[model samples]
Target: MEPSVYREKWSALKNAPGNEDALSQLARQIAFSFVDRYYQDGLYRAEYIDLLCEMATSFSDTQFNNKASSALFEIIVEELCDDYEEMPVEIYSRVMSQVISYCRDVPEGVALDRRLTDFGISTFDDLYNRANLVHSRRYTYGAGRPPEKIILLSRVTIGADVAILSVMIQRFMKMFPDAEIVIIGNAKLEGIFGGNPRIQMRRLSYARGGGLFERFSSWHAALDILQTEMPPETEQNVLLVDPDSRISQLGVLPFTHSDNYLFFNSRKCDESAKHSCMAELANSWMHDVFGAGDFCHPTIWVPSGVRLRARRITESLRAAGCRRIIAVNFGFGTNPRKRLSDDFEIELLREILKDPRTVVLLDRGFGRNELLRSASLIADIGNRGFHASVACFEDSQYPRTSHGIIGIECAIGEVAALIAECDEFIGYDSACQHIAAAAQTPTLTIFAGSNNMDFIRRWSACGDTQCKIVHVNTLADPGHVDTDEVIARIMEERSGKAPGAVEPAHKIPEIKPPRRTGKQAKKAVDS
Candidate 1:
């Protein structure tokens, strides 16, 4: 689980030194932010509460005032129980098990822990049974020919790389022809051969909608779906596929296997193990799950119809006198804080428009409203010293005929197709970038606001050598990045010029954040 506000502040407090007061204040502010969100979300999100627990623990450990932190925590928890439904008992217990250890006063901690446990909250095991018990119809597979069944448990959602997960499932079925496969995970996940005839899909009940026992029952039901779906073949291969989960404790997966491929999926991996990207981790763990498999980057399947539409769209843009078609996704939908600042974007726009033959197709997806807020935000480039044609999605010649920054959300299919048709792609860490890379489009990803550079490398368009990732952690300001540098990098990519060749007319941005003079250097979390 990731903390939204205190992530950087927490690391800073742990590091100790300059801005101690500022960091502590920020920690408190972050804590309250969680509390506000928790109340706003109607306390259904146990995850947010878990973040609060962590904040309390951090602040109570001399990082902040223990007495004040304890008071706030007590009030928050008490108010939480008063307002929320049944409350997330198991989640609280999981958190409180350590919360007590973090408390400065053992007597006070003991009293608090006992009172909390008395809520009759179901334990983790009980929750698991209640949630996933339905899916376990027959534990063992009956004797038969080579394993005839494969069950996979995952949590992939619709907005995520459903295509990659889909392809993986399809590949698995192809890899083992005899095994009948069933993928049980997120309900919203699509492209699962709903009618395409690729693989089977079943929805795992979400734990969020229910109370204590009910929640775990939902979780157990998800697991049970895996169990009951298993074919009772002589060779049955049942596997759980949550890379982030600690499945070794369940004792269901085998410790070893005769087949390397089957063995990889049946074994457990240390969650603490680090990898560059979740894909890399998934791939590695997948290798652990299924033995040696062909390495493939994530990609969405573009139907022939979509391809033809994209071509028409591109051709129309070309005929309209927009020469170089560059695609841009500002990733503001996922997290606006991470979006490229107005200054940087404006600077980049000016530089790109400077090329007479170049016309950028900005992918202002459905969430563009969240980024632009109003029409006034987008400045007229002509007045900004560059004559560039801009069009909103509503324009008759919008995405098809006119090429400019369309500040409106577009359908996923259209976005993918447009990206496929473009000459080059520019985006932040987003699905657009991923899709573009998967399509083998030349992409320049500017990642400056992530918690760590590892995430950048991990998610970097694997298998695409043409992809250029520029990691900038500008210290002076993060939200406002070095647009000039990004522009230079873009030109370099197009001209095949060596990096940093463009002479900067102004100060070059720092690759890393400004170093603080504190004793220990604390880095922020990767967002």
Candidate 2:
């Protein structure tokens, strides 16, 4: 539907009593239409943005009592930030100011605002001006006298943490040899990077599916942690690096003194480096800031126990005559646009099952909806006369099938370990793809959603492994996708032959391996 139609629908319901569902749906439609038009025409419509901001204000007035209401507001705000440069400056300022106002009106948001004020930011404008000033200065600490402690904030998503945060940790480790490194984020960081001795994890939970104020509450939680990490007595001796992290709401909030803080605006890319992925962009930013030498590709450190369990699973399949293992994940994490049609997944699985020597370790993705989707996919495969097994990560028994599907429910670390054991990994543009690439496994990523070519370039998996990206414009119509061509490209990737229809991103020639192996790293963690 066009923006005008959505706008009219929203107008009728904007003030009417409690058709909250319909109002929320109309708001979402309007927001998505705005994004689609922006991508298609390469222009931002100020009228549409104004309408979105007005709708967000209305939702906030209701205190975002419902999940749908809060989600609508978040969608609008995120769309504006996704291509922030294209958004008009006045509109951006208005929306951010409204966000601050909305936060002040609620208890959690009030706490968040107080925290920012404590850090010397009296308003949204104040935070942005100070952050921009820091960005322009691009200063680094003295080479001879590095800070005694360094704090790195998590990017708040597993994929970004693997691609960007891990690179920063490695680079910082080298640059400031004696600095104590602390990470502020969820427990998942421990699974991914806990093995590093120099790193410490401080938990600060962000509610991904909560209301707007609930999501903002993490900033307050982050400040509480920072108070313990960097007290006033030694504030100047500590440095905090914000990698455009969500904890700071993409640098909309300040955590430390500007002189002691460094923010890497991961979204800004020059004309010459427009196609660089986040890992590459981060390395370049570090180089420019500290004159740091060498490029660091993405890396992960799976625990030894997880690796051993993954080995047992793969060995069982190998003994059953399956020579090649393929790990696959289809979850897209709250974005339906990122996924292709069910028919596409079914056809792709059928094609992979054609090879008798290959076994597919399919991931039953997180959450109820994804679990049901995977279950249906498995049933569809069985109806077509193929054998399948469903098991958990801790299951000791393995399916002895030579060429079929083994659907497993596992944790993130287990998924990484399984991918590490596999001959190759296949998935959508999700965290598993980044994890697979970091483990040095050849990866095939089917890129869907977003017409933004720059977004695709910035997020392409980066590691010292073959990563082939097949961009399928499924946003318009999934039926238009050539399933046969995609299957052929997958086959080409497996055979180590140049893909005919798809082009692979250039691989980083070498990334120094982690300081310790899985078992050795395991010992360090235990000790």
Candidate 3:
């Protein structure tokens, strides 16, 4: 069936009378059609898969009381999995888990274990154990048989790319001086790591906004690239490093032989190092895998033209008598829980503006929502009788306004360059914090939402400069946070009085987990 016809039928059934049997049957049919089209015609429709998953989850037990309905649901699962071998492991797991949860009395012949075995794992625990074993290995490279090419998969997100992959690239350059290093990631990587002659970036796009199964499309492209780079004739002479990349669904999919593949299970490795951040963990993993070497801090090589543009902006700010430039970004990536309330942002801006010589170079973040939020923040701050100027990347000059917020909308590279020029950086637990630390600028990160101490420790910005985190349990109540104390701690870090202080001011008490909204619940299933 065509996509439009299937969508129309699904919508009609959903809106029509309470015929549970009909809805379930139509859902099974659409799912089977999806699997058939994907296998027979190479037409993988993400929307069809999304609809099927939604229907399966939305069905109540009353709908599945009959044997036919239950059998149809089971067929849907088995057919989808059996035909499409390249489906992402995470997506497959999510769908199966949801089905099992709803169908408590699943038939003995469901073949859950058999299906998992097809993906090279007996269970989720087995997957982690295998990853842990890979990370624990301390293999020494043969002195005479270094790989001819090193393929480094991207960590997908900007923050992880900077904190983890950059370190890997730097270490690989030093370890195998003759091997050609190829980076597989998005186009933005060029702006950040393009300047290095030793590293070559191969662009592979991953749809960050696509449906769950849609994300797996990039893996096929990456697989083709790997085949061309590492043919069977020369497989042993090439190395593939997987840094828990989304491209391969965190190394669940096989891209090369086990001997030639190295997966850096970032989440599981270095569990005993409770205080170590991801950058530190990555460095430790490198040392263990390649023997001990000098620790490499995360680094970015901004393009020369981008660097010049950043310098012009900073110089314009300095020419306006702004002695200290502070780069601030409030982007929280895909997780809205990591962000604080608007009042909190306003208060933080107020504190930074207290220094008459400091000028705030605020980033009007990406997407419509973030852009709107940043604009609202600037307006709210201005209502308190503070000077604010809005600027863009195209502007060759900035307003001669000192001790005020200058909101600018620019690219990621521009933000990195500005951070390089800044004396200090401040933001939420987002990419800018990592970028700032990479530039060796003192950074203050106001971490919120999560009380997971280990998570906080693992994600803290790492660099030679001072990187401090102020934990706020905004998940419970943002208003209850001691804004005064938070601001004071930030100022102390700014004054160089608390050098190397990575701990939060006070321990964040454990609170009840927040109930996930409908959209958040869907996102949880998608992830």
Error (Å) of candidate 2 at residue 227 is 0.9
Model 2 compared with the native: what TM-score? Answer: 0.84
TM-scores for the candidates: 0.57, 0.84, 0.72
Which candidate should be chosen as best, given TM-score against the real structure? 2
Show how many residue pairs clash in every candidate, following the order shown. 24, 0, 0
lDDT of each: 0.47, 0.73, 0.69
Candidate 2 residue lDDT tens string, 30-80:
667655666688565555544554565455454434434354445655565
Better of 1 and 2 by lDDT: 2
Candidate 3, run of 10 with poorest lDDT: 518-527
Ranking by TM-score: 2, 3, 1
64 in model 3: Cα distance from truth in Å?
20
Q: C-alpha displacement of 451 in model 2, angstroms?
A: 2.6
Give me the displacement of residue 79 in model 3, in angstroms.
28
Candidate 3 residue pairs that clash: none
lDDT of 2 at 468: 69
**Cα lDDT tens digits for candidate 1, 421-463:** 7777787766666667656566677766555443454455532
Q: 1 or 3, which is superior by TM-score?
A: 3
